[model samples]
Target chain A: MTAHPLHVPPGPVDLDAIATDATPGYGGSKSDGKAALEGLGPELADLQERLFAEGRATGSRRRVLLVLQGMDTSGKGGTLRHTVGLVDPQGVRISSFKAPTADELAHDFLWRIRRAVPAPGYLGVFDRSHYEDVLIARVNELAAPEEIERRYDAINEFERELVEDGTVVLKCLLHISKDEQRERLLARLDNPEKYWKYEPGDIDARARWDDYRAAYELALERTNTAHAPWHVVPSDRKWFRNLAVGTLLLDALRGLDLGWPAADFDVDAERARLLASEAST
Target chain B: MTAHPLHVPPGPVDLDAIATDATPGYGGSKSDGKAALEGLGPELADLQERLFAEGRATGSRRRVLLVLQGMDTSGKGGTLRHTVGLVDPQGVRISSFKAPTADELAHDFLWRIRRAVPAPGYLGVFDRSHYEDVLIARVNELAAPEEIERRYDAINEFERELVEDGTVVLKCLLHISKDEQRERLLARLDNPEKYWKYEPGDIDARARWDDYRAAYELALERTNTAHAPWHVVPSDRKWFRNLAVGTLLLDALRGLDLGWPAADFDVDAERARLLASEAST
Candidate 1:
């Protein structure tokens, strides 16, 4: 019997939904995200227990890759910090990709990223991912028009390969408005404590805000494959973003159907016997 | 008034304690380690909070370095994992030094390590540290006699400088008996799940344990200075090792009288106002 490979659709993301101007009020009052997260928390806790137990019992673990891509100041770090809080460190890994090394830039765009994938039974969080090709590379005019075209195809194929091999790909694009970004940037500048978060370069990026939005739209349209659909999250509301992202992560992890390996012994019975032995001794 | 620095010591480490057989029953009973950790938790938590709050408020966060050196089966990772749990991530950092990379080896021994120093108001944990000059460099016969001498002097001076500049340096040497190590090694080999943790090369190292001991003894004798004292922990008991190490770290952090930076405004009082604004809107 021949094995069936996973299939992916090549389609552009519906940009209208992503860029919707509905002033749904930041972190909606109705609490859909919160309600969803409450349901997801126990599932995440269970998954974490199973994952760690299996890792220790079997000595083999599955790896998870959570890729986050978004506009500047889109709370990527915040999301990462919160997401990891749910899982065990023994089975989790995080890598934040900043500027590529000279060696990294010399190779194909995906080369450096592919090397950082987590081993099985582990979770790897990518702050910015291969989509850098479609974001920073486009914004800074670092690559030629044709190079960008090649990269989009390469990323799709690369993600497909990871998913086919039991790697779960969960990607999020944090959505925030230009005005909201301006306010946040101002807040960073106004607060002496947050001054470290701001850079003069950020202002230059802000000036090209329209360009970034158009670039993001194109990226979502061109690279949002079925195996890895981009979740456009409304992130003006911090609590809502956390709730939404946390719920999505919990759901994705639960869907993997992770379970503890069969025990080497009946732990309860053995534990009781060990306790009795100690008592007698 | 003539400005003068504090009467600082030659090195941060306490050399006197290094050579002593500090732990009589290391690896003997795991319960001892658990008790030590229990006593340390609150102290560590308090210090971590103070340091993190100071860092966030003042932005002049001091750096802390805890260096762990041990034999193959000793509990460096366990010590670090437990210690890190006591501190906030925003206020702590950990780096496990593996064998030198080609780029690392090309520079001075401390080049790679120096970069791993935590930012201000942060704790940096080194799984193993520059003591490799005396430990592995001596064991593996990597450095020339003169070069090794220079490193020891350099390490002493470097650590002294860090302490003078407000970096706290705490070093621990986890000491386990040969018989205890052998049993732990055997357990690793016997447990199929833990087999991966055992390397055939460890057996080779076990054979040369005497040489490693000599190197460690020499490291303690020469490099342990007044500012940094090497706490030789009994690690035959993994739980006890964790506890002793945690206690040591908590003590170091608590010794530093960290407090909140002078607030320009009453932020907590303002919190209610901010929430009210959100509610009114």
Candidate 2:
């Protein structure tokens, strides 16, 4: 399998260096990209089933965690509907984090996140995950500067623990330009069908676009590790974004090298039992 | 828009009366039925989104709970993969109930069931559900006969509470014959790929099929109410079963009469704000 080309390299990061509309490894037209994404369904489903089977039969602890972070209208929900929808929903656990509740605020930030981790053999998706602690928390001054600085290390340690325990943490920063966000927001405002998605607070966030961008750049730079790397997915084109994330997931599942679990019971004995039961019926 | 013919009416239910292979309301070929199920997808998705938007915008508590109860090898998992897989996973919450833990057993049976109910606007599916308390427990005499008798009333009241609270409870018993189950078990035994799904205890349960069927009949007769009806879906043909359940879900959604949520904010103001933001960018 070809290596994903969107991986964020370790160094001082510049968000503007990559174009939000560029379809990095894919050279296909929009229609072709969609077809390619649909083509990934069978293989992704098979691999996911094998992984699930391994966990049930052999008690394998291996799992996958796909964390999606993006600006408003950067398409986290779309990625879930299009890319993650390709696999069996039984084998996937999706948790979307919202603003911290009073109970959540009382506990450590990771408290809610820890509870939502997927069980063995499940693909866990975090939409706007713990990274929000550093992103929004930083931009809005929700925490003290020292405490905000400390969360970066805390997140790294928490993710490293997950990786060491056999979780393949694949993080994607859905990169979109301010112009694209403005256009998407305007589209939502223009269509009554999309009105429910538009929030007044979205404009407030857009107003602090440069601040959020700097926060994201720092978050990506500090947390990008060998065990769990961050991929910057260009998101201006919804089709390419969906296709890239699907391909990345397929690659991760393929890396598991999963196979059909061996039967624990005697096959011949089970066969005889079935036949006798059939005869009796 | 046709009424589902598989619904178990308020009178006595004979498990043997309903043919396990009959497609009562549908008269299409297997391929045609499959196509028909696929055709329900777009409408299902649209209605689900409307329901979701309504919940988000207006705080509507209306939700759908699909309870799937069936014998082992009766295609509950297959139905989930094919039928429930139609809608966006974000809008669907699926919980598979297994043997209760010590924590769960300490409380009432409905304790865990209550915890897994879907939030407002979400479509919740139970792979196996509270019905198990009646079916497996009564078949095995796990509870006292008097206690078991009282649970029928308890379940009815419980479902009534859910229904009155704006939940549409749609229960389906995936009905299959003993011969069909034997064939399915045999097929599992013959295929190593299906080994993970086969359990030694499944044969144990198969040995007491008649008792389990009797228990099911009693449970359905007692708990079947005007508010929460039970549908006996024939599971001999996988395609028909998928289509039946998908159609039932679509009907339920359409019955909700969901419309696109009206915008809460001033549309023109947000539009102007977006344009101004674009100008600033």
Best by lDDT: 2
Tens digits of per-residue lDDT, candidate 2, A1-281, equal 22243988898789999889998877778989888889998999999999988877877899999999999999999999998898888888888899999999999999999999998888999999999999999999999999889998999999999998889999999999888898899889989999999999999999999999999999999999988899999999998899889989999999999999999899899888777763433
- Model 2 chain A lDDT-worst window of ten: A272-281
What lDDT tens digits, residue by residue, belong to model 2 across residues B1-281? 22254988787889899988988888788889888899999999999999888877887899999999999999898898887799888888888898999999999989999999988988899999988888899999888899888899989999999998899999999999998898888888889998998998898899999899899999999998998989999988888888999999999999999999898899998888778774433
Q: For candidate 1, lDDT tens digit of each residue in B1-281? A: 11111122344433233322334434434555466566566667667766755655565747678888888778776666665665434345666677898899899998987887766677777878899877789888898988987888889888887888778898878777766666666665556445545555566676676778777767776776887766677666566567666766766676887654554454454333333332210
Candidate 2: stretches off by over 4 Å: A1-5, A278-281, B1-5, B278-281
Error of 2 at B88 (Å): 1.2
Index of the highest-TM-score prediction: 2
Candidate 1 wrongly placed segments (more than 4 Å): A1-10, A14-63, A71-74, A86-93, A97-123, A129-169, A175-213, A226-229, A233-281, B1-61, B88-93, B99-122, B140-147, B157-167, B237-240, B251-281
Best by DockQ: 2
Model 1: docking quality category: incorrect
Provide the DockQ value for model 2. Answer: 0.66
Q: All models: lDDT?
A: 0.66, 0.89
What's the TM-score, to 2 decimals, of chain B in model 2?
0.96
Position A30, candidate 1: lDDT: 36
Instruction: Give the lDDT of residue A60 in candidate 2.
Output: 81
- Tens digits of lDDT, candidate 1, A120-236: 666677879888888888989989989998888888899898888667788777777666766676675456555545454555676676677778878877777888777777777
**Shift of residue A132 alpha carbon in model 1, Å:** 5.2
